[model samples]
Target chain A: MWLRSHRPAAALMKKSEGTRRDFLRACIAGAAVLGTGGSMELLEAAEQSSALVKSRVVIARDPMLRGAGTTVDSKRALNLLDHAMQALFDADHPADPWKNLVRPGDRVGLKVNALGGHAFSSNLQLVEAVCERLQEAGVKANDIVVWDRDTEELERAGFHISSAPNHVQCFGTDRTGYEEDLVTYGSVGSRLSKILTRSCNVLINMPLLKDHDGAGVSMALKNMYGVIHNPNKYHPNGCNPYIADVNMLPDIRTKMRLTICDATTAMYEGGPAYKPQYSWKNNALMVSRDPVALDYVGWQAIERKRAEKKLKTLEAEKRAPLYIATAADAQHRLGTNDPRRIAVIEAQAGR
Target chain B: MAREMISLADVKFPDVSPINEIARGAELGPRLLPLDRRSFLKCAVMAGAVCGISAFAEPCAALLPWAGGPTQGDSQFTAEARFYEKLQNKKIKCKLCPRECVVGDRERGYCGVRENRGGTYYTLVHSRVCAAHIDPIEKKPLFHYLPGTLAFSLATAGCNVNCKFCQNWDISQVRPEQIRADYAPPKTVAELAKQNRCPTIAYTYSEPVIFSEYLMDTADAGHEAGVRSVVVSNGYMQTESLKAAYGKMDAVKIDLKAFSESYYRDVVGGELKPVLDSLVTLRKLGKWTEIVYLVVPTLNDSDSEFRGLVRWIKTNLGVDVPVHFTQFHPQYLLKNLPLTPVPTLERAKAMADAEGLHYVYIGNVPGHPAQNTYCPKCRHLLVERVGLTTGQILIRKGSCPFCKQPIPGIWHA
Candidate 1:
């Protein structure tokens, strides 16, 4: 039941293709069992199918994304995002995915990552495309909020502050502050940003993929670190259980619907700060409903780039992103991090 | 789901002013404004007379002002920090505390207030007074030091160690810029203490060691103005730093969290040895020292640990050094734990007393007889206290009225 059919491509698959798919599914199941402390029952409960519980991740790349200057091509980036969404949902029209993601009355929050600053931040163009798509799906402009840790960082990253009633609202947690009540989960204790607790019911995580000195990767799961009041306290011991624990908070785990990583430009080393010398243009936007799978794929992408640059892998560097596997454990069960369980649909935008 | 779409303009935004706006005229760094006499008097009266520990009786509402603020600006005057040595590649190693965080350029230390910017180290919380109040020295649990007198208490955000059972985590665990603060220069703090009839200035609430420069400066100013400075701290600092800082302080109460190194490491994120060294350093410097051990049930309230703690104090610091067995209420990350039993605190006090440590007291239990200071010689109540408010003092010229046995404290007849 966990392996829900997405497209008719599965029906017309060749015999050899089916066999390869089964082999991949078995590998995924085995990995899941090992990751979850050999708890076959939890794995069965999480992914009920003997076949792979396929999580579709779309990596849509546009060669023209990096323009002559440092600015991104907004039109091309929006086109790339549209293609990614359409492919992710396997829908006939691009708008169908938007409609499926957000209902007309849903109060949507776009949690954007701007900690990487100007050089490596969530693309404002991608954010604009998301707001436009949400509006096109009959969501009110006022209901869509784009936010990060602070408004100053958002402004520094080229996001306009629109707190007006008739526009897509843009502000940070600095505006709303945090809930007075502290939420305790595992080793994590924090007051969640009121933006997540009080205002929005649906959340879309928009993190910029980058290298982290401590967490190994700043992706979807780490993006939620911004939603809490105290992130500095949770940075010890490679941010393993803290990252997984913070993501498992009821308000976050329940409301977070999708993760769209802005990977057009990423840092392979010396990040989550924006180091120009360590930066590279991947010119890709990754889309996924499973945050763990998306982060796993992002981690692989950063490792691949690091390998290309003749740099040590995150594991070799002794800062592996262990939270991804921890999130998939029996206690959390947030999502799967197994590569065989993740079907990454790579496509060139504007094809 | 039909949810009403609330406008952003409708939401009541917390104050987003930068901390520098409030911390304007502190003398440690470049002043936003010259110190004016009228402004000084006004601020002194506002900070000294009006504010009290009762001002924060409702902790939640009081913390709202510090919940959110504007991002800290790089242009804010940075006070060059002490106890740091420059390293290669624009790095610096912080030696203020035992953590010894080796910070790179544009990185902050473990405390989050000290930063390494372009190879130079600076303290962002130098003169920033995030919380201030007028409280009795007994509130600091320094019962033996200037009993029943109010001390002008203040603190800046940040702590060297992260205690899971921290009662003041809202301020201690946050960055300086995240909270709203006011600038009260050292001279201003001293003047305020003098004007408000307070005999002492207390560096309290948060770990004062993180703000050692400011604390030392304020202590010097207070000494010049005939007011003493007392510190309420976790006592997690380098030996040299401790000696230098405690040399200026009049009295110190160290929150000795636990006896075991494992407990200090796993629960408090610090080492026990440095804290012990700090106690010894204070004794060497001839600073009046007190110890408080918050007894959490089943965690740190065992017999062996209590015996070990008191034995160390009896051997190293002396039996005359006052030790308080305080009750622990579940807080911060340890909310699932139950409150420390009254019997447990009594048991700790009894054990410490049995271990030959004089002046042992039980805290957080008002109306308990152990809260009073009894003469060890005559077994007569010398000073009766209920909570932080001291009642009858039967001591004359620093001795018990009945037995004429001298009480070891700053006793003012």
Candidate 2:
């Protein structure tokens, strides 16, 4: 009863045509200098970023993207990512999508889910492509930080720990530590990652597309748990109000620029960690500004896959991602959870 | 409808490795901790130098062996947790706490340290010592338990409840992996307690309820080594788990966060009834237990709440239970709130005293008169304590020396 429909209304926007040579033309800069804020241009950037709640969530699927096992083709991965970004911002240039999402001077952070370990994790290739796109958008490679909760978890998921002064830095919150001050939002009282608070001005949320056993969905909104010091405290009650409330944190609600989910390998069940038997190569990446809508679409996709696998629906099992509706509720007002209001843009991006 | 747009694509991500390490490690049956000094240094350089654990989870100074090297597969640190039942779909219901989290495969419960691996729940924090120190037994404020003695303290990361005013939030509110920990097994813990000349080993700094397995093992180990074990906890746990876990405790100190359910639900992220039930059970078991009410300025410092708490303690656990009204300083998430007024704590003590409790004292104030344990019958100063230091002990043969009135405590350690 919680999920209103299995399929959201669809609209696949036309992809922008940007030549490979165009993307390769931009030179990678020296490592990003941490904490160098663009304080002068804040007013204009803030104004342009404070758009109303967006309801568009794009699904860029290409079956040929996944090779034998979970190995993802890096070139095709970068191509799909570029198309998805273009479609997300409705931009024409290959780099225009990233430029539209974040300013060149804005410090970018990619919060990836590393709990799944290497065999099944947010594809490192996908994150690398995002770093490449950010650099192409004129965002200094050093300015982008790719991080998760624990160093070991990040390493287990096959991420190399790096703080290279002239390259895209990847590490965990443990390296930067959490702010001493606590950020209380709804029921969550946690210390946010210093990497997010001190180093990055904007965040790029890249969550693994998986079905959480407790919360029923681990998607864009749920991925923000990595930014805070205490995510374990908010998992009770199907992570309902906590997930929505976490997104309600002003820093997350505002500084979050976009969500790019890796569905190249999605988990239908037994997740937030990978289970080989339940896993499948979904060959898709989802992009959106609206976390709630993206989650709604992701939840529906998992539900559909579960039905095909002859498994009980998440609702039947009493673990629907109710946070999607809660996020759109009056108190949160994060984005749209309504199927009617959401536009699921489906595209075979690389085709 | 807002003009929101989402883009999806199948990105064939390319070119990277070192991710396959876990697959190889898992097939090879977990990594072991290194034992030698050279191996320890090598492990640290390999683990920490790569911007791995060393740069992030700083190794504890007292660390030894350092096997798993702070990444994963510290097999010795994990033990199947008690009080959880496997359900369908690789999910398990953790009956350890009231939350009773139904965790899926490879997921964890609310405590974050215990994980459900393939339907079998394993506590990753087993023997994981993140913070260890020797503190005064009075520091645990179990004045009635063992006065004028030091207690060896240990804690693993993770607490069942999130109190806004947690003084030890750095260690209490974190996952075990998030903090740097020493690999001290039960025997090691017992040995450390003995070496430190502590009469008791205190399971503290974080909620001990979450590390029930560690506490139980350590308690047994301490007993074998001629040392007693005590636990300082939030008392928010399942009674069945409590009876089994706390049953091994020589004594317990419970931090009663609040008196009302609303305060518990809103401020402590827990329920009050379970904590109260645990207290009653402890009383029934005849295990020595002390209660500490941290009187937050506005939240739990109401007169009615104090009266209710003392009255409940009196009616349920009897007047023999020692209740300490601790001062609450602004910390964690409740910084905007003022320091819990001394008058507030005094008021709580006053109410509990008026409610016919025998042993009531004010804590966190170094030299307050109430810091001394006076005879309930003759008002003679029985045990004089200054802050965490014991100044004088006049109780003889478990009775007030001045009046010979019977005192309920282990006055002679």
Q: Candidates' TM-scores?
A: 0.83, 0.79
Best by TM-score: 1
Lowest lDDT 10-residue stretch of candidate 2 chain A: A25-34
Every model's DockQ: 0.25, 0.46
- Give the range of the ten consecutive residues with the poorest summed lDDT in model 1 chain B: B15-24
**Residue range A244-297, candidate 1, lDDT tens digits:** 999989899878878899998888987766777888888899998888888999
Output the chain A TM-score of model 1: 0.88
Query: What residue runs in model 2 are displaced by over 4 Å at the alpha carbon?
Result: A1-54, A66-72, A103-106, A140-142, A151-167, A276-280, A304-313, B1-73
Q: What would the DockQ be for model 1?
A: 0.25
Candidate 2 interface CA RMSD, Å: 1.7
TM-score of chain B of each: 0.83, 0.83
